[model samples]
Target: MKAMSPELASWLRGRTDDSVTVKRLHGDVSGRLFWRVFTGNGTHVLMDSGKIPVWPWIDIHELLRANGFRVPAIREIDTRRGWVLQEDLGSRRLLDVDDGQYMKLLDEASDIIVAMQRRLDGRTCADSIAGRRSFTPAFFMAELENTLETLFFRLLGVPMNELLELQREMRTLCESIDPSSVFVHRDFHSSNLMVVDGRLVMVDWQDARFGPPAYDIVSLVRDSYRDPGHVWEDRARKFTLAKGNMNMFQIARTACQRSLKATGTFSFHYRKTGDTRYLGYIPRTLRYLADYARICPQLDGLVRKTYRTLDKYHGEIDLRDFRSANIPEVRSR
Candidate 1:
C-alpha cells in the first residue's frame, strides 16, 4: 500500500485530533479510495476520490436525505480535493445476509426506492444531475454494442454478423420504451446498499440520473450478486407494482436492458482490471438477460443465439483465477 498524499494528510490532521488514525478500506471498482478514520470520539469514513468530482455525490445525498432516505450523513467535504468525510454505515451489505433476511431487505429497499420516486417524480433535478445523460434509445443501443464488443466478441467468441443482428433487435426493443423523467439511482444493486441500524442505506449516488422508475426496481430484484429465486422475484415485483405503479412489462424490459449492460460492465471490468470476481457475475447476469428475454418476444431469437454461443464454450474457461497480478490485497479496516 502507498502512503496518503501530503495534502490529504494535512487535510485529515486539520479535521481531527492529533491522535486520530486513518486506515484504508476496501473499495469497489470505481477506483475511489476510502479510509476509516478513527478519532478520540468516534469513527467516520473519509473518501479520497482522486480526480473524480464530489459535487454530484454531495448534491444527491442532500436530495435523498431531505426526502427521508437513509443516505450517509455528510460530515465534511473538500470539493477541490475530491475528499469527503461521511457517517460510517458499517459493512453489512445486502449481499451478506441469509435468504429470509435478504427478502425482507429487498422489501425495505423497494419501499425506499418508491418513496424516493414519489417525492421527486417529474421534479427537475439539480442542474448538475440534469446535465448527465438520460437513458435514451442511443444509450440503450450503446449498451448493446458494449455487450457485443466485450462479452460476445471478446469473451464468448461470437461472430460480428451475429452480434450485429442481435444489436439491431436490442435497439428496436429499447426504442419501444416511452421516455420517462423520474429520478433514477442508476446503480441500485445489492452491493451499493448497506444495512445500517436495521435500515437500508444507499451509497454510490454519483451516477444517478433521470430515467424510468422501473430501472432501479429491476436493478434491486435482479441484482448480479445473488439470485433471489423465483419466489422472491415475484414478491419483489408485487411490491414494486403496488408502490411504484409499474407494470410487469415495463419492469421486464428495464431488466433486460440493465442485464445487457451488466454483462458488458462485468466483462469490461475483468478485461481492463483483470478482476475475476466480476467474471463470476457474468453468468448470473446472463441468466437474468435470458429470463427477461422470455417475456420480450422481440429479442427472443437473438437471445437464443446468445445462449448457444455461451454453451459452446461453457467448460473451457477458469474465470475464478483471473485476478490482476498487479493489484495488491487491501484489507478493510
Candidate 2:
C-alpha cells in the first residue's frame, strides 16, 4: 500500500471535513485504486484511476443512472484528477450471498440486462459514447491476441509462428457473434454487481458499448469468478426468451470468446502482480471454451485446432481434467 499522492489528498480535502479518513480497498485487475472514505457524516468510495482518463466512467455513470440503472451515486468527479467520489454501496458483492439470495440477485441482474436492451435499443443509442463504439470482428480478434500472447505463446510453449491457422479460426469465432445487436455491460459479472439496498447494482460499467446480445449474459452466468452451477443453461434460455432473437448458439459462441478473453485477463493480472489467485480461474474458462463445442458444432475445426495446439505445447492443461488440475503457486513477472 502507498500513501495518497499530495495532489489527490488536496483534492479530497476540499470535499471533506477534518474528520475524514481514507482506507484502501481491494481493486480489480485494472490499475485503478478504490478508497473507502469515512467522514463525520457518512461513508463513500473514492476511485483513483492513477493516470488513466476517468471521463468514460463519469459519462457512463451518468448515462446508466439517467436510464434507471442502480449504479453508485456519484458525489464528486474530476477527470483531470482521474478520481471520483461516490456512494460506497457497501462491500457485499453479488457473489457474497447465500445460494437462494444469489439466484434472486442474479435474476435481478438478468432483468436489468433485458431492460438495458429495451431502453437502450434505438437510433438514440449512437448519441452516447457507449452506443457509438462496438464489438467488431477485428475488435474481438484484438482481444484474443492477448490470449495468444499470454496463455498460448507465453505460458504454453506454442510458437508465435505456429499461430496462423489458430488466429484464422479465432477470427471465424469472432465472425459468428453479431456486433451492435444491443448495449452490453462489457464486463458484467458477479464481482462487478454490488448488493446494495436489497438490489443488484451494476458497477464497473465504463466499458458499456454495442456488442452481441449474449455478451453480457455470457459475462454474468458464465462468469469465471464463480460457478453458478446447473442453473446456467436455464438462465441463458430465459434470457434468450426475453430477447426474442438471441439463441443458445449465439450465447455459446460469445461465451467461448468471452471466456477465452477472460483467461487472458486473468493471466495478464497474474503476470503483472505475481498473484496465484488468477491462475485458478484459467482452467475453468478453458473448460468453458471447450464445453461450447456441443452447442456450436460449426466451430468444431477451431476447437480441435485450439486443443491440438495447446496439447502440443502445454500438456498439463487438459480440458477434460481442468477441474482437478493443480496450478502451481509460481510467481509471475
Minimal lDDT window, size 10, model 1:
324-333
lDDT scores of the candidates, listed in order: 0.75, 0.81
Which stretches of model 1 miss by more than 4 angstroms?
A: 124-133, 243-245, 313-333
Q: Which residue segments of model 2 deviate by more than 4 Å?
A: 315-323, 326-333
Per-residue alpha-carbon lDDT of candidate 1 for residues 195-253, written as tens digits (9 for 90 to 100): 88777889997888878778888888888787787854585568656764556667777
Clashing pairs in 2: none
In model 2, the Cα lDDT at residue 129 comes to 82
lDDT of 2 by residue, 86-152 (tens): 9989999888888889988888889999999888875756667897888898899899999888777
| Best lDDT among the predictions, by candidate number | 2
List clashing residue pairs in candidate 1. Answer: none
